[model samples]
Target: MTNAHDHRADLTASFEPMRHFMILQSESDVRVLIRRLLLSCLLIALIAQLVQSQDSEINEIQVGDYVRFELRGNTYQGPVIQATTNGRLLIVDVSVDDRKSRRQVKREACVRLTPAEMNSVFKPVPPASKSEPIELTMPTLAEPGEGEEIALTNEQLPSVDVSSPTVLDWSGFQAGKRRINKVPFDADPDLPYVLDISTGTVVYSVASDHSTDIFVSTDRPSDYRLVRIKNHTVRIADTLPQHGVALGLIRDETDHDKGLCVITGLSTGQPRVASAWSLPKQKVRPLYCHYRRLLPDGSVVCVYENTLRVFDGRDGRLCWHCPVPAFFEPAVSQGGRWLAIAANGRLFVVEASTGRCAGSIPNLGKETMQPCFSPDGKMLAVYGENRMVITRINDGRVVLDHQANVDLAPFGGESLWTAPAVLVTPGGYLMDLRKNMLVWKYQLPADVNEWMGAPESGWIPIINDDWLSFVRIPHQDVTQLSAAVDQNALVAIQAGDSLRIEVEIKDDVRGDVDAFKANLTKALESSGYRQDISAEALLKAEVVRAAERTDHYINFGTGKTESITYRPFGARVTVVHRGEELWSANQAGNLNYHIAGGLQRAAKQLEQPPANLFQTMQLPRRFLSKKFQNGLGKSSVSIDGVK
Candidate 1:
């Protein structure tokens, strides 16, 4: 029995070792499974954190933050007024060129403005530094080009008495000299003058009150005297040195006797205040610069070298000085509330009282003239090299940037500005500021040789060989005439006349033909004409030349290039009646930056029928002239019979 038990014990020992090995392997498998599960969880958490960080970066923008964004190929910067819950769309308040507008943009496209940019828009202009030198990119003075002088024989000159100075009754003179005698005087035509239509007063510089000075003597010149003509009487206003030249004159609208005169020394060519004249009382004030204007509140604003200074009229104390890059004529708002000046190649508006910059815009053009404020001071108009820019004063937004057909440069005449209307000098084209379109063209009488117009008052001083007469603009009659002409044109078109045009663009012109067709059709309809495919009239346009040009400019210290592409074309429109050519006209397209724009210009030109067509329709007698007839068919009417 002992032997059998020993064998069993030995077998039991071997089995025990195998059982322990199995238990150890099972424990190892469990630990390996737990480690794999933990690793998977850690990987998922890491991915979630990365996604959350990306989302926060994208939606970081908030309300009331100033941001700049790109939309439709244009970049705009403004404060965010509202934001969508999803943070996708945002509403922005944009002010460009002194005009304000609201626009909606995608949040993804916007970037927050830097601290430096914010300061530029909202901060007050820094005080002028006397140590800094003036930086000038262009000429300071934009003098008008000299016109050819026409030599007049002594026979052509008017023979007038120099000792007598006369002025007719203001009311009678305004009423076409019905009961007033024609006043004659000898004054230097080249001298600048200020005419107050409200007070019927004229202020001009003269060599002497008794001298009929036709020409200003260069050597041994007599002292110039400021003269005032009112109530059929001429009186010496003030006398200045022979070297003193009047730069500008401003008469107090509230008090005619109170006036401010800017004078420059001929020898030094430095501008300074001659005096603030209170009729017989003259107070010499200290101020300098030819580009100076008198504010309505008796403050004087002057721009010199690289600084703009405002002086208190009562004490002649410097109110404030702003640092500017260059000098240009500063414009004052009607009530002296705002001031606009060109500096650093940009136009800036400042609070006349505090010198705080409201807003600024670059690319104001090379030669900006004195900006004119609207009657209500809400709109500002700037003219430069025939280009006009009208901006709203409250917010800096450009309402209009137009290349005007008329000359906008001041030609020894004042630019007439009434609310929403501007009458350009020389051309006499009245433009609507809000509408951004030409309203009308005024025609002067044949007898008038030289004229000055005050469109706001609807009266113009017409200078003739014999007398200077005033004529009131017939606004009511002009309105009626315009309406009648429009009616006649519409009637002529609706009668299935030859005005029905079909536009056909040549295939050789490499451009968007479909766009051209659509633009041409719309233009024809606006011009009181019909477009029909089956019409007997055909307007054909062909591209003469297509070219691209590049202009390099330094903008805000950055070099930039502008790609200018233009398509020059010509159009011939012909109308046939009963298989015979009834009317035909040929026109060359104006220079346009786009092919579609070129076609549109050509369409507008072709819309005007031949002058003979107006005669056939029995239009007004004035319409028979080619000049007047051309005006009637276009958007802007020519009243002065420009050829």
Candidate 2:
């Protein structure tokens, strides 16, 4: 029995060791499983943190946040007034020409403005020194004896208004007047003369039986040129007064010394001799003389009889030439990239570099038409007596075809295209093409004789019997009014508020009114607003017109007949609460080309309500006449009442 017990003990001891080893192995496996679970939890937490950070960054834009954005290649900075529920659009309150205006921009295009940038943008700029009238001696012109060289000198003229305060400002437009004293009071009417505002230079002619004298004067007295051709008649080219160069013809009864001469360096404070070139006698017809133009790059474009010719400025060498029919005065693009001319009752756009036909627009009336290219060179605008057509150059697309109710022709001058608006001269009408409406019209003062504008400088020169003055089109003062409305709207409405929508259409209009109403309801719901017919806030939408018209014309670029059906739509919307209108918006059919397209765009606009809904709604009123002041200061509303 003792021996059996000892063997059993030894066996038990060995089994105990093995059991301990198995227990340790099981513990180690459990530890490994726990470690893997801990690692997985840590990885999941890190990934979640990264996703939250990205989401916050993407949704950082909010109302009242100052931002900078790009539109149409122009940079604009403003405060975010509204954001669309879908995060696609943002309404910004931007100051244009000192006027507070609401502009809608894509959210992706906006960047948060740095603190420094915001401060700088809001900083007040010192006002410019007021202009004081100063008199200077005008250049004296004396006819020289036959074959005698005559030199004329004049006192320094008043500095050009280029140094004057700009008509535009971040806060708004500042209207002031500056007098140009260089124009002689006793200037001969018969002699041709021109004032080039870009260079502050003037060229005039003095003719006598013995000699014809052409005098070129700049702001500096030392920079003056006098050209004398004995027994010859000098006629200053009326159309070639630009780029600090003066072009004219020196003609005699017998065709001796009959040629075109250009004077350069008139604006560089250095006057030099004339660069003379002879043209074929037959080519120097009246049409050629009237159609000549000096391009911005010193090249000269002229219609010589039946051909369009570009002459180099350095030596009057022919750079390029193309055959053309009878044409109106050609307009060179701001950068001299394209040349626009109306010929054979159509508009032709030619490449300034190679003289290749870039594009053309047909069916322009046979009546006189003036063509003007936009600053970007991507669009062309042709103005007629009753119609204005704007076309896109890349594709033969007619963007706008506006028929006016009155005579649309300029009173006595031509139309001028600036960055913000097109100034139709003589009539003093400032048309904002983006809105397709006339923003301002100046009533002529009794003393003012004519109106001419400097497109590059934004100066409108008014010629009176006494002197010339430069002034900007006066803009209405709506900054304070807009601010008041914006502030009121920002405080009046809250998220998740219940509202009602009502739509009304005119008898003449054709549209899906029900669809529009449904879209409005959806947009409001997406913005955290509940739609209730009995809600205090009532949104009213009225469609005044919706019609389509087919237009057929010849495409000058493809030389093919094309037809375009334009759908015109107009709508007016207002937000009313407690029997008072809190906000209003209107879309004129003339501004938008398509009915259905316009309605969809408008719905999208509504999806992103502006922070200052009142000011935004008043945007369409800018097109009204200045005397029309119906809703200027009616934004006082109670948020409690809206609820």
CA lDDT, every prediction? 0.37, 0.44
lDDT by residue (1-643, candidate 1, tens digit) is: 1123222232222112111000001124767668645643563354345335434212233434433222221232222222322212233332222132122222123444443443333321111112221121111112222222211112211122111121112332222221111123443232222232222322233323332121111111121222222211112221112112232323333222223333322111112333332221213443223345444344566555446666544333456775553434555554456766665455666667666565654435433355655555566667765556776654556767654334555332234564345444334555544334444556544322122222233455443333333444323333333444443332211222323434455524344545555555555554445567777545443333223333222334334533333344444444443354433434443433223333344444433322222111111101111222222322221222232
For residue 520, give model 1's deviation from the true position in Å. 13
- The per-residue C-alpha lDDT of model 2 at residue 245 equals 53
Residue pairs clashing, model 1: 96-396, 96-397, 98-395, 98-396, 98-397, 99-395, 99-396, 99-397, 167-232, 443-640
| Model 2 per-residue lDDT at 608 | 29
RMSD of each: 33.6, 32.3
lDDT of 2 at 305: 63
- What would the TM-scores of all predictions be? 0.36, 0.41
**What tens-digit string does per-residue lDDT give for candidate 2 at 1-643?**
1123222232122112111000001124778769755754574365345435434212233434433222221233222233322212333333232132122222123444443443343321111122221111111122211221111121122111111122212122222222223223344312223344433445555556634555554444344444444554555553233334565555556434345555543332223323445444243443334345555445666555655567654345566765554434455666455666555445666665556554465634322544666655566677655456777655547766544333455533345565634544334455556545444445544222222223443444343333333344333333333333333332333456677889877855655667777767766665566779989877788776445555455546667765555555567676665675554545543322222433345433432223222222211111122222122322211111110
Q: Highest TM-score, which number? A: 2
